[model samples]
Target: MLAEERMAIILEIINEQKAVKLSQLCEMLDASISTVRRDINSLADMGKIVKVHGGAMALDDNFSFIEHNVEEKLALFTEEKIAIAKYAASLIEYGDFVYIDAGTTTEKMIDFIPQKDVSFVTNGFTHAKKLAQRGFKVYIPGGEVKFVTEAIIGAECVMTLKSYNFTKCFIGANGISVSAGFSTPDVREARVKTAAIDGSRKAYVLSDHSKFDKITSATFIPLNRATIITDKLLDKKYTEYTSVKEVL
Candidate 1:
């Protein structure tokens, strides 16, 4: 096939799958790895898609609309996220008060939270509901709900968070970079996460390796403030500023 025809097929695949790994694309197109890489790079430069490590993801405008599309996002890295969540949950003792941030990775941590006398604070409506149902002392911050991420944010939420201190905070970010620190797509959510980190004694960032080296708008917190808990594939630079625990 011509280069344009192969590139067109690649775009169609990414649009249908939302994400495609480099190796998979090469196999699908019956092309050399180098040729496929060039196609991905060219397409990325053209603003047709976003290139992630080892793969490319379709540029969906509603990327932050996670609440309405939890299933789709969850399927992206099911096992890696589960491993990270399990490792993070292990850090929480039975009586520890924890702050959980809003994101798909943080939501997975809910499954690992043991049924104990733990005080859990959150800005995520779905997380708050699940934790409350699980019989933990869950507090949902008072604020306007952002429909995109189904997270409660605003001045009221920040004020409510100030009332309680936490033993640990498990925050999630849309992107993590050595240069940019931690970031999120929405400014309001970033504010909420910043408050959570400040209110906790020890902060833990739970994200998959996919988030590493990526950058998004709105800086939430500095990399120095928290220990990063992520998959083993994270870049070495992340280890420079904070303690990193790689979940196998």
Candidate 2:
């Protein structure tokens, strides 16, 4: 095939799938890896697509700078959040040291978590309270609480995470992208999330379909670092970068 023909097919595949691996593009175009890489570079330079490690993704125009309060977020995606939360909660086992991040979905998870033997550490003030009320041993970090999300964020929160090695952690994200990975609007909050994920043996990011293709101010985790539990996955290509579980 001519270079133009191959490039056009590449663009079509990425646009359709939202993202694609370099190897897949090469196989589809019947071109060498170098040839596909060059075409991807050209497309990236043209601002038609974003180049990610091992692949390319459709350019995302949705960038979130502001974070809505918990009440506002609670009203959106309620059903989907509950489904994802329930599935996340089921992953917790007896005697597990779980870290639950602050967000509407993670908060819902507290409701479904039935393990009474598990201990919890959280940066979310509300999550900590809810977990305690549910008869679980809950520990909250000391830090400046962000009023909008009611989440503890700062150096103290990050330091607190360092002392405990959790068996599992459920985290929340403002955005998830092939290029930007898992991101949130606040840098301080991102730091706490980073610490939590780093200190845990396993990490899961709970999100809804609306979070996909979105970018935020700071990225706390890479795509491969955690499994994603969502309402639905619109892009099959994301599975190539990370493990994605769709609850609905």
Candidate 3:
């Protein structure tokens, strides 16, 4: 595509979502980082956009937000997600009270998890249903569903988490930055994830390698907060600061 055409598409996406990440733009435009960077720089110079840490923001936007629904997320990093989920599932033992956070990865964990004396508490509608179908004990919080991710989150969700404790919690994140920490796109969902992490004795974050170095809009958990289970941990800094287990 022409540089002008690519820039116009980038503007459309950023304006629609208030922001667009470089990784996402690369996928959308089928362009390289260098090409996307050049387009972004040109747009910023023309005052058509504003450059941010890992992406660009709309000129008319007051804040930046880039998010995806369940369908969009389910397709990316399929192999890595499966490996991470498999590793996370291995940590579960009999009679353990587990908390499963909502995400494409954490949702897959239910499939690999053993059918032992395990009970689950979750904020995901899809997760709850899947766990039930798999004949596992499942508890769901009472909250308004966030249709964007098919996850439940609100004050009620937080309240439900307060009453239950978990032996281990497996969660997901949109971004994991050493400085900014684990984050998602929405603040409401972040609260649920924070509560889950706080309530668990052993908390594990299930993420792909792509999540590393990215910083999303909402900050939920700090770096070194939870042991991360991923397909690969390329950065030595992650291990220097906290525990990161590689599955691939």
Q: Each candidate's TM vs. the true structure?
A: 0.71, 0.77, 0.75
| Model 1 Cα lDDT, one tens digit per residue, 69-158 | 555667777898899999888888978989998778888888888777789888889999888888888878899988767789999998
Q: Please estimate how well model 3 matches the true structure, expressed as its whole-model Cα lDDT.
A: 0.86
Say what the RMSD of model 2 is.
Answer: 7.3
lDDT of 2 by residue, 1-248 (tens): 78888888889999888767789888887889999999999998998887765677777678666799998999999999999999999999988999999999999998899856999999989999898888889999998989999999999889989999999999999999876789888889888999999999999999999999897767788899999999999999999999999999
List the candidate numbers ranked by TM-score, top first: 2, 3, 1
> Could you tell which candidate, 1 or 2, scores higher by TM-score?
2
For model 3, residues 117-226, the per-residue Cα lDDT tens digits are 99999888899999999999899999988898998899999989988879999989888876557878887888899999999999898999988877676668777789
User: Best by TM-score, which number?
Assistant: 2
User: How does residue 175 of candidate 1 score in lDDT?
Assistant: 78
Give the range of the ten consecutive residues with the poorest summed lDDT in model 1.
61-70
When 2 and 3 are scored with TM-score, the better candidate is 2
User: Which of the numbered candidates is closest to the native, going by highest lDDT?
Assistant: 2
> Clashing residue pairs in candidate 3, if any?
none
lDDT of 3 at 173: 89
TM-score of 3: 0.75
